[model samples]
Target: MLFAFSIAPAGTPGDSVSAAVADAVRVVRESGLPNETTSMFTTIEAETWDEGMDVIKRAVEAVQAHAPRVSLVLKADIRPGHTGQLRSKVERVEAALDEG
Candidate 1:
């Protein structure tokens, strides 16, 4: 199935954002879904901010590890310079999933 997964969060503190992202990864890892893409995304925004970007990267990496066959789609509001940074990561993950 073509799944639309999103991880954008509302305005939140940097730490809380990472925490939320970790939690989401945990949930996905534990959900035991055959296709991770079939599982809905949760609290992805927590992984989007400057402070939270690393956490977001780690979380997505974890997800990729746990569900190597799943596709991931990430959406973010970005200005000119940052237009495709996170989006690039998301696409990379999706490509990896496709390859796997």
Candidate 2:
């Protein structure tokens, strides 16, 4: 499964939320799962639903330490019996573009 999520502290004083976001990303990185952090979201490849949700839950908690409330946006591509779709899926698209 590929789980992409964004977690941020809301109603904070500053215009920037990079610090809090970094905390969330740190959690993802520490998980040692196949993952990528982009400007909008962090995407992780997990073998099971529990694994992915556990990461997301911890990420939210990391951001929560920064503010009273947090905003989370989550999207998932749940394809069982598949692994490494994190890179393979993008590689397929890039290959298609090359073919075109």
Once all C-alphas are superposed, what RMSD does model 2 give against the true structure?
0.5
Model 1 spans > 4 angstroms off = 1-24, 27-39, 44-48, 67-70, 78-100
Model 2 CA deviation exceeding 4 Å by range: none
Task: Indicate the residue-level lDDT of 10 in model 2.
Answer: 92
Best by lDDT: 2
For TM-score, the strongest prediction is 2
lDDT of 1 by residue, 11-56 (tens): 4435334444455566554543221332345432222255344444
lDDT (Cα, tens digit) per residue for candidate 2, span 1-100? 9999989899899799999999999999999999999999999999999999999999999999999999999999999999989999999999999999
Clashes in predicted model 2: 0
C-alpha lDDT values of all predictions: 0.44, 0.95
The clash number for model 1 is: 4
lDDT of 2: 0.95
